[model samples]
Target: MKEERRRHKRLDLDVKIELEKLDEGGVTTVKYIKADVSDLSRSGMGFKSNYKLDVGTFYDTQIQIWTKEVIDAVIEIVRCEEKENNIYQYGACFVGMTETDTLKIDIYQLFNEE
Candidate 1:
């Protein structure tokens, strides 16, 4: 079995998310790609993107963690594996999150233990 390398536990969710790719210079792109937030944690989140995002690349994202609540963040692409049906499962790590945002995610994870 593959070892779980994640530092934080994740909550299975379907939150709405928008991701904007960053250029090599770490500049945010104008185009924002929409994808479902399949899973979440204080450290990072998971989703699938139609566009192939390179691992180690940076992206700016807006995630609707709760109804009527959205948080903006920067993330580094950690994994991008091509799954069946031509979809890519993308995993990223939060890069520039505040203490408040980290607490919010911890609270959410606590409230949503599977």
Candidate 2:
């Protein structure tokens, strides 16, 4: 079995999130896509999307948690795998998430564990 290497625990999630590709300078491009979130953590997230995202690319998006609060974050694609029927699964790390937002996720996770 592959050893777990993640720094934070991931919360299983199922939600749709909008993503806008960011240029090298951190500016948003005209390209936009929607992805289905599979899991979330303070450091990163896993998602699947029909739109293919290049590894090492950055994207801006807002995630709405179970409490209905939205957190804006910029994520960098670290891994991508081509799934069946042209769907892509991606692993992304948060590049521009504030500490407060990260704390919120942690708090939610703590509550969920009980």
Candidate 3:
């Protein structure tokens, strides 16, 4: 029998976070935690949140890296699934991430070198 292998980029040091949807004109929103990032890709991320966000809902959020550097980006809810503990896992696609923000994330990953 052959064993099946799964491929995924491991994530480390998940910190507590808060995310909020931006307003129409100006960027404003309600801050709420439970936004723990689990998986991250070039164009999206998987996170846990108690708040229910509709698919396609766009949010402008600031991710605080372990280095204390903040990376700001816009994200859109792509999918959501309810977990066993009443916690919700959300998959968000990067809607509009600035080059600087993307670069910051890449650099952080390099230094961490999981």
- C-alpha RMSD by candidate, in order: 1.6, 0.9, 4.3
In order of appearance, the predictions have TM-scores of 0.90, 0.96, 0.75
| Model number with the top lDDT | 2
Clash list (residue pairs), candidate 3: none
Which candidate number has the best TM-score?
A: 2
Ranking by TM-score: 2, 1, 3
lDDT of 3: 0.74
Q: Model 2: which residue pairs collide?
A: none
User: What is the lDDT, from 0 to 100, of the residue 99 in candidate 2?
Assistant: 91
For residues 1-47, write the lDDT of model 3, one tens digit per residue. Answer: 85523233434547666777776785667765458888665567789
Model 1, residue 18: C-alpha shift (Å): 1.2
Worst 10 residues of 2 by lDDT: 23-32
Residue-level lDDT for 77 in candidate 2? 97
**Candidate 2 C-alpha lDDT tens digits along 14-73:** 889999999977667977799999999999999999998889999999999999888899
What would the TM-score be for candidate 2 when compared with the true structure? 0.96
lDDT-best of 1 and 2? 2
Error of 3 at 62 (Å): 0.6
Question: Which structure is stronger by lDDT: 1 or 3?
Answer: 1
